[model samples]
Target chain A: MEIFSNLADGFAVALTAQHLLLALLGCFLGTLMGALPGLGPANGVAILIPIAFTLGLGPVASLILLTSVYYGAMYGGRISSILLNIPGDEPAMMTCLDGHPMALHGKAGEALAISGIASFIGSFFATWGLVLIAPQLVKVALLFGPAEYFALFTMAFATLGGVTASNQAKSAFAAALGLGIAMIGSDSQTGSERFTFGHIHLYDGIDFLIAIVGLFAISEVLIFIEHHQGGAAAKSSAKIGKLIPDFCIFKRSIGTLVRSTIIGFLSGVLPGAGASLGSFLSYSVEKNTLDRENKTFGKGDPRGVIAPECGNNAAAGGALVPMLSLGVPGSGTTAVLLAVLLQLNITPGPLLFRNNPDIVWGLIAALFIANFMLLALNLPMVGLFTRVLLIPTRILMPVVAMISFVGIYGLTGSTFDVMLMVGFGFGGWLLRKLGVPLVPVILGILLGNEMEVNLRRALQISDGDWSIMVGSPLAIGIWAIAIAGFVLPIFFGKKVKNQMHADHSEVEMEEVIEGGD
Target chain B: MSDRIFGFFGLALSAFYFWATSIIPDSFMIDVVGPRAFPYIVGTVLAICALYILLRPDAEPDWPNLMNFIEIVFATAVMFLYAWTLSKVGFVIATVFATSYLTWRLGSKPLGSLITGIATSAGIYVVFHLILGLSLAKGPLGF
Candidate 1:
């Protein structure tokens, strides 16, 4: 009953004309960003962060806009998968398996409609799950002391590789690099300069936004330039026959949608498991259970298309739970969102719910509204979005570059930050070539200061005793989970990554054969 | 192998970071854990990770061909120059040149690139500066 009343209040805030408009715009822009290859939700939100700030949107409005983008991107990721056989993002990889096949069969519109519906269902239920579960998680989080927080942050880093990273060493190295970057500027507690190197700008440290825009946006431009591949424009030859799927197709996928939503939502709640794992797990599980003997699972199977789409979107919603409740981002995009929250001076965690109920509830309500908007917007606008795929990389990359420069300059009015951003961009490009993951680096930067502060606080409480980290059973349990999360991935991660690649190549091979015919 | 080179680079970075951490003067009001303590831990962890990479190298990564590599360098140089000149030459002028060059390199015709560059610069100026009322870098010719 209290939850209902709180939600009603949230609706009151979210229904305001300004917030609603922001949500609509966010969804529109997010879909556009997601339709383009190499610009996933992370980069989409990253690019818009400056704009949100420049507009001076209040905390709730800004969150509503960005989270709408996050959800919209998840919905939009399926467009390229169906049309071009290229996933707009990692989580959409599974969608490409069945989606492109459907597209090849001239059921492209149907595939797009089904995916949009699935994404809506996944997000809708997952947001409810977030509403129910986050408060309980916050109850658990309320028991945490400095030591527990340190342990939790450590666990986040350890598991950030999830089941995707091919090499944990590279992930660890990236995390350390991010922490190194975080160590720049004057020490907050002591006010002593650590890595400023006598530069005045260095005193304030590298803004995480600059690092994010640099690593995700600028590095992307460099990669585009290096590939020199003409824009990944949609093939005019591919046909989209119908806008609506048959009722039977929807009925057939209902079970898969429910199961995938559950799997994705749970995967999202787990720190660092995120949408990629959710999609992978949901797709694999559905295949093993429902399509074990079908022989048509990947041959334009609607269920195959539905499973991963629902799973990833649900996971996207699920990622928000831990972020809002525990101050631990569940995915890369959520990590970037955490940076946004920190920039707004609104630290997320248990207290965020207590201190800023309006923000938390308003954001939750806006997510609900945004999901409906995305479904309505996406279904009618599939052709519009597919047209986005036709946008050439040649024209798009320069716009991206200009936005980064102008946006960053507008935010801090600092030319030095712009220069520093370019440096990070180059460094990020080099790191990517070396097979280092960027998400953990971003996470490390976001969590580094908090992790250090907690550790120092814990030590201070225990009079510099190291044993206090595992003093409580809760802390010990968290540490054990952290250790397990780090070690277990090494054994199983390779198999999962290999399986994904194998499936990818298999699909590509099939496409080539079909093209030949 | 590239992995080995990356490992050595990481090791050097960690060593330098550690030395830098060591040189931080202790603050008078420092707590039980000083500002340098966390950095020291981070540096040590980085050193260990670098050592692990060095000891167990992965398969060699695919390197870009020389021509592709040169193109990448050129693009990077253009970016650095754009950053350098952004404040000096103003956002509109700098953006026009940067976007034009980048678009051209990305395979657009020169005229198309120039049009794209100009259109993008003006479009952004109107949206961000004029409409949104956000301040941007100004040139000698002002608006």
Candidate 2:
């Protein structure tokens, strides 16, 4: 009854004219942005955060708009994957395996319809799961003390190491660098500036917006220059023939869609396992189970197209569970959303349900609305999205750069932040060239403050004794999970590496997509 | 740079970070693990990872050629200049010049790039200023 009333109240808030308009705009822009060759959902959301803040949409409206963009990007990503043989982001790599072949076979319309339907079903199920499970999850999350929180953060980093980056040492170094960067502003506990180097702008500890713009947008521009000058790749001329999949086809794939959604959602709820992992895992599972004879697994099998699309979109919804309930983002885009929340001074956690139910539940309702909007919007607009690719890189890149600059400056009203953004862009490019993952760096910066605060709080409660961190059973359990997270990666590193090598482009796609956010 | 050189650089950065952490004086207000502790712990762990990377560096990936490197450097310098001049020259003027030059470099004709630059500048100004009620920097022209 409480959930029902809360949801009804949420619907009241989300269904408002202003919120609905922003949600539509976000969805439209997100699909357009995500359909771009290199821009991922993270980049789309990160670039727009400053706009959200500057527009003064209030917290709930801003969140509704941004989360809509996040969902919109997931829907948009498959368009390019199926048509152009280019995955819009890492998760869409699975879609490309069969989506392109289906396109080549002149079943582009069927593929698009099936994937759209799958994405819809996936997000629909996952959203319901979020509404049902998040309250229960929050109840458990509320019991966590400072020690448990710290341990959970540590576990997040460990899991991130396993799933995101191949080189554990490099990931650790990147995370440490982010933590070091976060420590620059005046200490929260004390008033001492640790590493400002006497610069006034450093007082606020590097505006995260600046870092995000510099890291993702600027680095992306540099890469854009490299590729654009080399002469752009040929645009796809694939034509859509039909508007919907056959009834028989849809009936045959219902079970696959449901199973993949479950897998994707479960993977998403687990910290650090992202949409890509979920999509790939679902694809593999479907291949083994449904296509035991391997008839049409990757050869334009409609199930192949449907399975991963469902998993990835579902995983997007799933990723919100940890972020909304635990304040721990499960993926790069979610991390950006978390940053947006923190910027709005809305700390996500169990308290969020009690204090800011409008923002939380409004966002949930927006997700439901956004998914439906995307499904409606994507079906007839396949040609429209394809036309987005026709915009020359020259025109598009400059607009992207200008928006980033204006957006960053508009938020801070500071040129130094802009300059810092440039510096970070250079650093991001250098890091990318060196094969260091940027997501972990961003995650480290995002989590560093909370991690330190919790650790100190735990120590403070224990009278400066660190043993209190492991004294509780919950803390002990989390620590064990963290330990397993750390060591199990090492043991399975070789197998993971070999699998990655088998699909090297997936790794490259991950690297490229990092710059989008 | 090769992985070996990168590893050495990482080692050097970690050492400097450790030195930097050492200089953060202990805080008096909060006694139980003050601000320095977190930085110290991060510094120590970073140093260990730096050493590990230094000792066991992976094979190097392919580096871009000098032309591509120069393009990247030039693009970065252009952005830095745009940032410097954004306030002084104001948003429209700075963005027009910067964006036009970027578009030109990326393969647009000079006239087309200029049109793109002007159109984008006008569009951004209209959206951010006129509609959104967020005032961007205005030069003497005062849009």
> Which stretches of model 2 miss by more than 4 angstroms?
A229-237, A497-517, B26-28
lDDT of 2 by residue, B1-143 (tens): 36667777877877887787778766667667877788888988787887887788877876788987888899889999998987777888988899898898898889988998999998988888888888687766774
What is candidate 1's lDDT per residue for A88-169, written digit by digit as tens?
Answer: 9889999998998998888998998888888889999999999999899999999999999999998888988887668888
Residue A318, model 1: lDDT of 93
Model 2 over residues A1-517: C-alpha lDDT tens digits? 8998899888988999999999999999888877887789999998999988988889989998899899999988998888877788878888987887788788988898889889999999999999999999999999999999999988887777555356788877888888888888888888777887788878778777788878888888888886654233235555888877887987887889888999999988987688988898888888889988967766789999889999999899999999989998877888899999999998889999989898888889989999889988888887888778767778888888889888888898888888899899899988888888787788888888889999999999999998998989999998898777767766776686567445546534643664477
Q: What is the TM-score of each candidate against the true structure?
A: 0.99, 0.96
TM-score of the candidate numbered 1? Answer: 0.99
How far out, in Å, is residue A483 in model 2? 2.4
- What does each candidate score in C-alpha RMSD? 1.1, 3.9
Shift in Å, residue A5, candidate 1: 1.1
lDDT of each: 0.89, 0.84
- Give the local distance difference test score of model 1: 0.89
